[model samples]
Target chain A: MTPQELRLACRDGSFTTNTSGYCAGYVQANLVILPKSWADEFFVFAQQNPKPCPIIGFSKTPGEPVIRVGGKDVDIRSDLPQYRVWRDGELAGEPADVSDVWQDDFVTFLIGCSFSFEEALLADGLEIRNITEQVNVPMFNTNIACEPTERFYGNQVVSMRPFKAADAIRMIQICSRFPNVHGAPVHLGDPSLIGIEDIQKPDYGDAVTVNEGELPVFTACGVTPQAVIKQAKPPVCITHSPGCMLVTDIPNSKLAIF
Target chain B: MTPQELRLACRDGSFTTNTSGYCAGYVQANLVILPKSWADEFFVFAQQNPKPCPIIGFSKTPGEPVIRVGGKDVDIRSDLPQYRVWRDGELAGEPADVSDVWQDDFVTFLIGCSFSFEEALLADGLEIRNITEQVNVPMFNTNIACEPTERFYGNQVVSMRPFKAADAIRMIQICSRFPNVHGAPVHLGDPSLIGIEDIQKPDYGDAVTVNEGELPVFTACGVTPQAVIKQAKPPVCITHSPGCMLVTDIPNSKLAIF
Candidate 1:
């Protein structure tokens, strides 16, 4: 289905599953809704740490539900498959629609997601290990610190994909073209160098097998913002439920710089 | 001095040393002059195996000394600092000028050298381990074979440089922009994976230090053509002596694709 159709289904409470593997060529994004007061500082934090929190689009005006930057008639309140409403940075509910709890001071941000670049890599014939194993991409907490703002600060989190050295090089080239979605990998080869203590034990997602000769290539992850927000203890914040992204009308190719 | 002046010095029998650091920011090529009989097949070989044998320019007509593609008034016979004269695949002599042995049926091919990309990497503030340690970049014969023509067939030869993982990623991005200069690295991390038994002992150049936390990144080298030509055993073949290259008027920046 077209992104508008899919989003309409979501708005009507008919689509509540993970958005992965839907609308093959379209861009999907991680959602972030914050109070206008916290959002300004969050914007600075995102701009400062783009690899983990690249902002692709956002609400033009606070409390306005329409998001024209990413698509036509994208409502920030109910267009996504699911959202996690937070109170004091603690999960308050996983709701199919947020119109009930939506605040007048809310500012919605659409952050670039890895799904776009993953489509690019798969199109280029590179195997994504997580996709092959039918699991979430492995993610880890690294000692690599993010550039911080007064209201948001935390270490960078990274998602892992294992590839042979040559394939890893090709992967780097492909990902570099889509900077909005984490760009090139932040690190590859030794995980310990980035303070990822165990390659097989990820902090956030299920660990996929790292073959004998394959290197675990790490890209900055969107989960970084969630982790940072939790640490900052924002009074009210909202984010997409894991894998239940906001599918957009924008084609994945639109994200490629080259 | 300009490349023309440098070529004139070589022509007048005044410059007889290596051209490694000379004519900065200009292209320096690995020279290969072959009899017209062997040139055709070698051209096909170079075209098929561009990573190791990227041909930047060649003689417009057989026996012509002037190379117009890369520079003005480039006399292949004496434009390089020194030339190695080969007879039946064996090194017959190393001379400052080949005027005494210039063959009318000779066709010269200028292969892209790593110096162009090294200059690029250094300009971007990336340290080249070979330049820092003051030695030749280590080269190895890999199991990765080149696509061959009838007369030219051999495994690829690669030059090694050590870099931390992040620097290697940056180096890959920088080098990818200059495909004429061997493009991105062929393999990185493991030497034995490419058939090199020992990282400390290279088949062709001096071995530099591979410090802790550094990967030995490998790029296909110009030496592969020389190795192939030697194995092909042409009646007469001419090449630049080690570290002596044919300096051209083309700026190194001209090689960048984007």
Candidate 2:
């Protein structure tokens, strides 16, 4: 569907499904809306650590749900196909819309997502195994530390995709151009060094095949900020339901800072 | 030594030592001066295969021995510390001055060398294992095919350096900015995948220690053109001796097309 059509469907509660394969050229973002009191600390956490929490858009004022970044008509509360409500940093439940529960003090943040660069890698003819297998990219909890804010503290979570040495080099070159979307990979080869034991079993998402000669390449996942928010235990937080992202009119090509 | 001082010393035959560590900030080049009869095919070879032979400077016309690229009063025949002569693809002899043998048909081509990116890697605080340990970077002949022209046909030769994962990423980022000097790496980790039997036994240059966590990163070397020239069997070819380079007045930063 077109960006406008998708937004309208999302607005009218007609198209409440994963936004992955839809809106081909546009940027779909990971949503993170929190109370103003908690938003400040989260902003600091993101600023201190950019790779894991790249902020593509944020509310200029609390309770101002009309995000100018996604487009003039893009409303954060209704645009995303689904949302996960968090009470005291614990996931309460995945909900279709949060506008009914939305408060005047809540702020929205549209963080950059990996789907943009995945499109680029695919265009370059490099295989993204998870997409081919029709599953979410296998993600892992790593031992790598993140610089903490007052309340936010957690280990970085990474998403893994396997490739041979040559393809991994090509992936690194392609991803380096999009710093907003987690930039280049954090680690490649020998998962054990990054504290990931059993490459087949992932902390989140479905496991994909890693062939005989492939090396597992890890990128900082968009799930990292949500992971951090849970660690901080902010009173209330709302994030996009997994794979149900905020599809912005912003073209994925715009995300390339080059 | 400064660029000017080093060139002056080389000109007077007072400094016959290798030019590797001298003239730190300036661009040092791989010199390949060939007879004009063979120049057209070689130019096509370099153009068709730019990653392996990124030409930074080429003479306006066949030999009148002076090259304006290096500075005022720079004589190509004598300014480099050492030169190797090749006849019919076989090593003829080593010569400090090729003035007597310099033919009007000789066309000089100065290809960008790794010195530019080595300085870049060092500036980014990534260790160049070969430089730190005071040894030449190990290079190997790879099975990776190169784009061929007429007589110039051979597999690409690659230079290897080891870095831990994080440093390797930084190296890629830095080198990506210098395409004229063989931008970015061709491969990293498990050299055997590139048909290199053992990292310990390099076909050229002394091998250095690759630490426990480090991976071998390979780049298309400036040595590739020389390897191709040897296979081409040009009646006569003149090249700078290994470790000896044609130092240009251009600063290393000037070579970054970005």
Candidate 3:
């Protein structure tokens, strides 16, 4: 389906769940909307740390509902299927549409997500464990710290896939081509080193099987910005409810810097 | 210096040592010349395995001194600083020039070498340990087997460097750009996994100090082909003397596919 068609369904509340497996070949983004007071610090946070928080689209001025980078009528407030409203570092509600509560001071952000690299990996014939198991990619909270802005500070979050030694090398190469989509893996083998005490238990997403002789490869994840923003505790923040993404018209190939 | 000028110097016997650290921005190649009887099998072997033995230039016809891909006036017999004459796997002699032994059925193969990526790493401000220590890069034989032809079969040979985990990741990404030049590392950490019994006792080159927290990163070495050639024990095989490469006018940047 086209991004516009998907957005139209989302706007009318007909599509109200995960954006995965929809709008194939197009870019899918993580949505972040914050009050103007906190947007500047978040931008600085993304600049200081790009791999985890690659900003693909952003609102130019406060109260701007449309993000032209994706479409002429891309309304951040109503395009996504679900929105997570956070108040003072806590989840206030999970709303399908935030237009009723939208404020004039809101600024939208669309950060690049792993869906782009996942597409690239699949194209290369590499098996992404989470996809094979028919579950969301397992994500972990890691000990690797992100370069912080004064207000935004937190440990990095990484997604994992299991591959044997040789496949891990190939996965690294394929993913490296899409820098906007978290680039190469942050760590491989020995989850403890990255501070993930248990490979079987993920903080987010379903845990997939890691077969014998396979190493779990970890990449910087989209959940990082969400985790960081929560710790910062801005007065009011809105982000895509988990797995609900802003599907854009851009093809995944466009993300390749080469 | 221009490739033509450098060739003129080598032909005149003014340049008779390792061709590295000179011809700053150009590609340096590993030379392998074999009689026509063995050339076809070796070509298949190289094709079967590109990462360890990427062929950058090859003679179109056997016994042709002309290397068409390298340059218009390039002569295989005299451009390299030194040549090693191997007689049934034994080093028969080392000569400054091989024009006397040049035959109508001899084919020249210019395989990619690691010097290109070392130059790239240095340009990226990553310290190449061997260059920093002013010593030869340490090399070892690994359990990883090369795809063997009828007569050519042996364990893989790898060159080693030490880097912290983060720098190792960066090195992998950088080296990946130049596939012809050994490409990215074959393995990192736990030498026993790849059958390198001791990191300190490399089969070739002097072992430098691997810092306490640094991991030993291994890359498929150009020496693998040479090692295979040695094991095959061909009646008449020739190679560039170690460190004495066939410097081409092709810039290292041209090797980067991206």
Strongest candidate by TM-score: 1
Candidate 3 residue spans exceeding 4 A from truth: A190-193, A198-201, B1-6, B66-73
Choose 1 or 2, whichever is better by lDDT: 1
- Model 2 Cα lDDT, one tens digit per residue, A41-116: 8889998888899999899899998999888588788877888999987889887878888999998899999999
* Chain B TM-score in each of the candidates: 0.98, 0.97, 0.98
Whole-model lDDT values for every prediction: 0.92, 0.89, 0.89
**Of 2 and 3, the candidate ranking higher by TM-score:** 2
Q: Write the per-residue lDDT of candidate 2 for residues B53-151, one digit (tens) a residue.
A: 998878877876888876667789998889999999999988887887899999999998998999988888888999988998999999988898879
lDDT of 3 at B12: 88
DockQ of 2: 0.70
lDDT of 2 at B109: 91
lDDT of 3 by residue, B1-258 (tens): 787778778888999988878889888899999999999999999988787899998998999897978864888898889999999999999998999988889999999999899999999999889999999999999999998899988888999999866677788899989999988888876788899899999999999889876778899999999999998998998899999998888989999987
Off by over 4 Å in 2: none
Note the DockQ of each predicted structure.
0.71, 0.70, 0.39
CA shift at B112, candidate 3, in angstroms?
1.2
Candidate 1, B30-127: lDDT as tens digits:
99999999999999999999889999999969988888985888888888888899999999999888888988899999999999999999999999
Interface RMSD of 2: 1.1
DockQ metric, candidate 3: 0.39
